[model samples]
Target: MTLHDDAVRVLKDWTAPDAPDGAQEQLRLDYLDHLVSHRDGLWRSCLPAHLTASAVVVDPVQGRVLLTLHPKVGRWLQMGGHCEPEDGTLAAAALREATEESGIPGLRLLGDGGGGPIPVRLDRHRVRCTGRGRPENVHLDVQYVALAPAGAEASISEESLDLRWFGYGALPELTDRSVRELVALARRTTG
Candidate 1:
């Protein structure tokens, strides 16, 4: 199956805990429907809504997370970006982004205890038009958690202004709620 097919299958099969007022649950269903309705929905350039994969990278022993200072958003956020054709699964795409952004290898995804990547969180957020001549779009992000190897040192990439490991209790002020949610989920699952 192609990436789009895999996404459709994954989203359709994924079941999360109760979302407050069932809003998140409804969004998941809607995302699945959007995927089915738009053939190019899985691509980043599709506009309006597209698939993005990201991961909260943690060092389990240290109980800290690695965050990137995104150049465009100017926020300390998780490592992730648009899905590429080479990505075979959402988890793979997330892993790829984590590795690329963190400059860390040998990272392992925390599983949901069902032998699959743990679904840490889901977020739908808007992207600003950053001189790309494209209108603002919505990113339907699939978030996961990756455990970094001990002694893993991160090198800053062009996509980020800085990379740093923040202890859970000392997260930067710029770390958003979505990232905090993902980190909390990761801690619960990995611990």
Candidate 2:
């Protein structure tokens, strides 16, 4: 199927009962509509491709953010995974992933500007892999910000060697540029 059609299919999964409510839903629908309307045929050819959703959980109090040292890429990255049909919304998918990867239950999802305990509507970006000999591996990531309580416990999943919080100012030492940008963006927007 075409990319737009695929996006629509994914959107249906996102809006199910388990999904986030109101403005977050609207943002997700709007984003899907934009994706559906703008394929222009090229993305259609990239069929069978995978789409992923991720969450960046930030502890504003410590000026620190959570990251995973992914086993596959061996780089520090945000928490996320492939968008499965069961995941109702992009944010839901992100939350599910963050919960699973970080082993942090009851994570509060914050979007861009909601006054709820957790804000809603966060920045989304695409990841283009650039290793020495490998071509780019593209991941369309729908990023959401959430909060993990201070000194909240975290553990490394088999998929990652390390799962830890780092001071935003020290993100430069992290292995991935995309994650660094994500950290920077989270600091700006969260601030």
Q: In candidate 1, which residue pairs get closer than 3 Å at backbone N, Cα or C atoms, i.e. clash?
A: none
Q: Evaluated with lDDT, which candidate comes out highest?
A: 1
lDDT of 1 by residue, 1-191 (tens): 88888878778777765667786677788888889888888786687788788998999899899999999999999999988989998889999999999999999887767768756667898996334676788888988889999999998898899999998878899988888877877777778
Q: How do the residues 44-160 of candidate 2 rate in per-residue lDDT, one tens digit apiece?
A: 123323355677888888898888887766678889876655665555677888989998877877743542222222333433434355545445455667778767778777777
For TM-score, the strongest prediction is 1
The residue-level lDDT of candidate 2 at 95 comes to: 81
Off by over 4 Å in 2: 1-48, 112-137
What's the CA error at residue 100 for candidate 2, in Å?
Answer: 0.4
Q: By summed lDDT, which 10 consecutive residues of candidate 1 come out lowest?
A: 128-137
